[model samples]
Target: MNHAATTDMADAPVLDEDPFSDENIANPYPLFERMREMGPAVFVAPHGYYAVTRHAEAGIVASDHTRFTVEGGVGMSDIRKPGAWRTRSPISEIDPPEHTRVRAALQKILSPLVVKTWKDKFAQRAEEIAEQAVARGRIDGVADITEAFVLEVFPAVLGIDVPPERIKLTGELNFNQLGPNNERVARTLRRAAPIMDWYQQVLQRDHMRPGGFAEKIYEAEDAGDFDAGTAPLHVRSFFRAGVDTTIAGIGSTLKLLSEHPEQLALVKANPTLLKSAFEEALRMESPAQVMFRTTTGEVELGGVRLRADTKVGYHMGAANRDPRQWEDPDRYDVTRQTAGVHRAFGVGAHVCIGQMISRLEAESILGALIRRVQRIEPAGEARWRPVNTLRTLDVLPLTLVAG
Candidate 1:
C-alpha cells in the first residue's frame, strides 16, 4: 500500500458526503447509488471514514467481527472517546466469547415462551389503538398508530417508566451519536441535557417494574446468568435497540402504503402479508441506517484493503437497496419474498436478539389495523426526521376508513 495507492481509495467518493446536510438525510438513496457505483469500499471524506455499500460486502463486514471488532464502539464516531454522550452498550460494544455469554443470557431471559406470552397483551393493545384511530377516520400515522403501539408495549415489556415525551430527545441523542459530532449531535445533546441523569436512573434496577424484563435481567444476574452490574446495561441495550426501530419500520410501512395505495390494498386483502410488508419496508428503508466495526488488522473487502485498527462502516440501508441484490431495488412491494433474505436485523453472531419481539409487535398491530381498516388514504404529507443514522418519520397523517 504505497502513498499513491492509499490515497486513491482514501480519495474515493465519500458515501455520506454531507452527513449533517438535511437534503441528503431527507433522501439518501441518491447518495447510496453513488456509493454503490463508486466501489465496494469507499472513503467518505465528509465523515472521514470508509463505508461498505453493497449487500454482500455489508454482510461480510458485519459477520467478520474478528477482522472488524465492535470494541472500538459500534457508532461511526467511537463513543468510548471523549465528549461522546452515550455510555457503551455492553451487549453490542464487546467482541464475542464475552458477547456470546451476555447474548446467551439475554436469549434465555427473552426466550420464545416469554415472548409468546406477550402476544395476547400486544393483540389487545393493537385492537384498542386501531379501533380508536379508525373511529376518528383520520389520524397521524406516526403518532396515532406507530408510536402508540411501540410506546405502549415496548416500555411495558422492558419495565422502564420512560416518559413518551422524552423518547424523541433520547432517540435523537442516540442516533446523532452514531455519526460525526456535527450540529445535529450538538442540537440533540442540548435537548436531552435535562434528562441525561434521569436516563441513567431509569435504567437502574430500582426503577424497573416487578415482573418486567429489566427486573428479570436483575434476577438473572442474581442467578449468575450474567456478571454482576451488567444487568442494567443489558436492559439499556434492549431499550435503545427495540423502541425506535419498530417505530421507524412501522412508520415507513405506513408512509409507503399511504403513497402506494395499490400496495396498501394488497396487504388489506391478505392480512398474513403484514409480516412480509413490514419486512419489505425494513429492507427498503432500514430504521438503523449504518453500523460500524474496527478492523483488527489489515483486511480485504471486495477488492479494497483497509488498514488495521481503522473503522469500517456498514451501510444496511444502501445494502438492502443495492440493485445487484434486489430486483427493481427501489420499488416498495409487499409481495417480494423478503423474509430471512434481508439483513435489517443484522447477520451471523450479532443478529438482533430481540428480532422476534419486533416481528411480533409489528404483526399484532399492523394485522389489527389491516383487519379493521377498509382503506388507507393519505391525508397529508409525511415528513422524515433527520437523525444521523436513523431514517424515521416525524409525521404521517392519514385517513383510515373503517371496514
Candidate 2:
C-alpha cells in the first residue's frame, strides 16, 4: 500500500503495523507507545483506518457524535459495507435522540434499587466462592474465580439459562466481530455455529425467566418503550457488553494483585481500595481495547484533519496509558484516580451504561478475596486469551494464603 498521501491530512503519520495481530494482542504497550508518538491520529495502512492513540484525542473522537458518529457501526468495518457483522446494535450503534430514549428506558430497568438488590445476592455468592478458593489453596484465577463467579451470578441476574461453555464461545464471537474480519473471526464463528440457534433463542422473551433483567427488557418492549422486535437485540446487547468485559476486568485485577503484593497489601489494609484496584487494573489492561467511529464530516483531531465518512479507531488500551494523561502511566497504582477520565469504561454520553453493575460485581468478588486471603501469589504463568478486540486472561494461576 502506498504510504504517501493516504489522507488529505499531510501531518497524519501512516503506521504499517497490524494492531490486531497475535503478537501485538499479547503485548501492545510498545506498539501503543509508538502509535502515540507517531501522532495523535495515525492512519493504519494494513487496516485502512485512522487510529486515535492519545487519551485526549480518543475522548474527542468518542464524545463528539456529530463529528465522529456511530452510525457506521463501532467495529473496524462499517456495517453498511459488504461482509460486515449483522445490523448495528440499537444501543451502541445509533446516534443521540433515538439513543437517548432507548438508553433512558434501559436505565430505568437498571435503577439503583435494582442494582442494590442484585448486590446483596452477588455478595453472598462472592463469599461462598472466596471460601472455596481459599480452601483449594491453588487455583486458576480466571476459570476458578472471576469466570466461575460472573458466569453463574450474571446469567442468573439476567434470567438466562445457559452453560459456561456457550457463554465463552459467544463472548469470543462477539468481540472478534468488532475487529477486522480475519481468521480469528472465521474460527470463532465456526466454533459457535452449533449453538448459534440456541444463542438467538435464549435472548428471546420465551426463554427469559420470570422476574429477571431479560424478562424486564421484554416487559419494557411490550409497553412500547422500545420498537417492536428490538427487545431481543437489547437483551443481546446487554449480554455482549456486560459479560466478557467484566470477566476480563475482574481477571486482570486478580493478575495485578497477585503480581504486586504491595498493592495487594494496600487494598487488604483499606478494603475500600478494592474498587480502586479494579479501576487501576482496567486502566492498565483495558478490557475493550479498541472501538471505532466514523467521521461524520471533515473533522480536525489532534491538529490533523480527517476526511468525511472514514473510520477512526480509538485504541483504549493505548490511551489509558498515554503519559500525557497519567504520570508514570505504566505503573499499576491502586490509588490512581481514573474513573471519569479513563477511556476503559469510555467517556461522554455513551460511557458504559452497565459500569455500575461491573463495579458491584468486581467489588463483591475482590472484597471477599481480600478479606479471606492473606497473600495472593503467582502459582504459574498467566496466559491471556487472544480475542480480536478484547484483552482478557485465558488462565491466571494463583495461590491463595488464608488470612
* lDDT top scorer: 2
lDDT of 1 by residue, 1-403 (tens): 2334443344344554674488889998898898889998887777667788899999988888767888888888766678755667878988888888888888989999999999999999999998999999889999999999999899998888888888767877888788877888888888888888998888888899988988999999999878778888888788888999999999998888878888889887787788889999999999999998887776666767677677788889999999889999999999999877787888878898988999999899888888887788889888899999999999998999788
Residue-by-residue lDDT tens digits, candidate 2, 1-403 = 1223345555578988898899998999999999999888998989889999899999998988988899899898999888767877889999897999999999999998899999889999999999999999999999889999999999999999989999999999999999988899999998999998998888888888888998999999899999998989989999989999999999999999999999999998888888889999999999999999998866778778777789999989999999999999989999988887899998877899999999999999989888998899999999999898999999999999998
State each model's CA lDDT, in order. Answer: 0.85, 0.91
Runs of candidate 2 with Cα error greater than 4 angstroms are 1-11
Deviating ranges (above 4 Å) for candidate 1: 1-16, 80-84
The C-alpha RMSD of each candidate to the native structure, in angstroms, is 2.5, 2.8
By TM-score, who's the top model here? 2
TM-scores of all predicted structures: 0.95, 0.97
Which stretch of 10 consecutive residues in model 1 shows the poorest summed lDDT?
A: 1-10
